[model samples]
Target: FAAAQLQADKNDVDTRLSQVAETTAAMMDDLKVRPALAEVIKQLIAAGNVVAYLPQDRAPRVYRIDQFVLKRDNYGQFTDIIIQEKVWPSTLPEAVRTALGVKLDPNTDEKQIDVYTVVEQRDGKVTHWQEIEGKEVPGSKSDPIPTDQAGWLAPRWTVVPGSDYGRSHVTEYLGDLLSMDDNYKAITQFAAIASRVVTVVNPNSSLDVAELAAAESGDYIYGEPDTIQTLGLNKSQDFAVIKDVTATIEARVKEAFLVANYRDAERVTAEEIRSQSEELENGLGGTFSVLASELQQPIAARYLYVAAQRKLIPAIPEGIRPKIVTGLAALGRAAEVNRLRTFAADAIQILTPQVFASLVNAPAFLSRLGNEHGVSSLETLLKTEDQMAQEQQQAMAQQAMQAATPAIAEAAIGAATQDPNQGT
Candidate 1:
């Protein structure tokens, strides 16, 4: 349905096009974009910078920071990107083959070609094309796409002012990591030395070195009582110190990466749990925000553009940008659910059930909790306010009928006992 038709009757339009959304989702699943997205996030964290581009003609491509060059406009927005891909010649367009003066070959499957795809916003238009060996490919020129449909996404782990690249968390904890590595190496070498068994021998001893080496634990050697003794590798104390230091360094590094687990006693207080949860949330809050702005919204907008272009969906209304809910914020939302659960539990403990019922909108609370807990079709699962009102009215009517039933029965009995003819 068109936007006007949708706006005129949202329910009907939604019901009609519901299958479109499902089919689109199924199509996206078939494209296997999730694996590409997972790789994009992996690169974002590992390298601190990643570039993902969605071409209407193909699955999204994830490029390493080294594989692409980028330029930001005066306002620090990405304006130009040149990505180099090692593509197979079989995948290239015929125009590209003609430009390269290459004849069709059955062995194209084994061939590799370096192609450069350049996309940039110029003169208020988004232009994109591909080139091989610095010469433009004849069939790879894209018509001027609207800036909003540019389909380029670059999400970074952490932004550095005036720098195009992002800084990874590993770099922030480099000192701790390096120190731990050295400590581990020292501990390992010391452990190897300490674990060795050495039997010291005197020249006066008659025990043969080969015999002594081959002797089992129960074997008896004929030698002077004090002639042969074991020498201790006394590096245990040094090893313990290195081990302790390494553990501490490891903890620090884990803390920096926000992967450290917070453990309490076997029985922990709600407050303690809440505190740890808040700390974790605060740590992820910034990460979630960065991904929402840098990754989520752009992907949603570009997908909407593509869907609209293909008429799989209606054009979006002006000033209504695509807003993603369950993308990067999933982490934050999980935290929020925990927070809400804690709040509800605390409220129940602090107030009587009656008081809690009076103080809170129970239906609203339950609906929110259900949604946060990822309940599907939540709107349909929960009764609407109108439904509640109708239910209340029905209950009242039933109660009134129940109270009036005996009175009506007595009136009918009196009328039957004293008939109209008997009274006359």
Candidate 2:
């Protein structure tokens, strides 16, 4: 009986050993398959510009095969190939045909279009495939992708950076220019400079060229140089550099009369204007508030005006200084107002001296300097008393006309009633 028990124990041990070997072999297979699959996927992403994300709960072993068309050269030609999803990136064929453009049909099967060709006959012999046949659509030219194929690619194709989708988003700013090379270069240059300008105006927050280009040209941005001098846009952390430059020039032209007065003011000094200008530009109120506050600070306005006439600052006219200063400074305190501030102090520090100097020494700044003391350009620029007189005259005339209109209408009605009686 003891011998029989020992043999049974040995048999049980052998069974356990066999199970262990099978499990080990299965695990090894899984490890080997996993790495091979990952490598293939990586290559697909690089080569085909398509990305697929499979979920864990889905059948992990499943894969698919499909077709795609690529634009190769400037000429239009169609090359057909079958691509396996598992080895998409590495196995996909490079596009060899030149593309003048693409022609697509939503109603037609994409497979038909993928391998389409035109046959030309000469002397009863087929000479060549003259062209790739395409379907014509109304209201628009041939689509780059067949409408039908777009549906298939939508789920799998990843956009390469700075490619179709990227340019499409900024199509408006690109203007009517058709040369892709020129447009690309212009946009890149604009982006590089605008990014730096925004960073300087506000250190906090962030913006990219794409976002800036996407913004509406008319929208108010806080750190924009024009905003700093006009709308009290102290909080503006970012701006479109080209737009800002143009806006500044426009503002200068519109307010040229006032700027001239500020330049001629004799009482204000340059130092005072410069100080107030600094307060407006770098301070919470910015340029606008500084000008407004100057109306009350008679001494300061006079000092700024005197300084302006002495040529202590740039050649900005005096007439526009007070308003410009007020505009520049009007943005008010960060915690106090609702305007957007895109940059921080740190960003402002990053600006090259030339950029900041142009902003600080603006023509409007010089005019404001002359108006600070209220004695010189500030008084001449505002001529507030004269403005009040004209406003009062207009108001009085409107009121008088309002009072007489009813009386005149009543008299006309009375006259008409008398006229009927007189005729009778």
Q: lDDT of each model, Cα atoms only?
A: 0.73, 0.36
- Ten-residue region with minimum lDDT total, candidate 1: 11-20
TM-scores of all candidate predictions against the true structure? 0.79, 0.14
**lDDT of candidate 2 over 1-424, digit per residue (tens):** 7974665454343333333333332443543435534543443332422212122122122223233222211221112212222221222223312242343446765443233222222232222121322432122222243211111111111223433211111232233233434545655665665555432323343444355556796865434443221123333344355445544544443232123223456688866665655543453232123223322232233323333344443333445333223434343333212221233234357886566665552323333333222122233444343586898999999999999999999999988877555766
Q: How would you encode candidate 1's per-residue C-alpha lDDT over 157-189 as one tens digit per residue?
A: 777778767777566667888888888888777
Worst 10 residues of 2 by lDDT: 147-156
Best by lDDT: 1
Off by over 4 Å in 2: 1-380, 420-424
Backbone clashes per model, in order? 0, 79
Candidate 2: deviation at residue 214, Å?
A: 56
What candidate 1 gets wrong by more than 4 Å, as runs, is: 1-31, 56-58, 91-95, 103-111, 123-125, 268-274, 280-289, 307-315, 322-332, 335-351, 355-374, 384-393, 416-424
TM-score, cand. 1 vs. native: 0.79
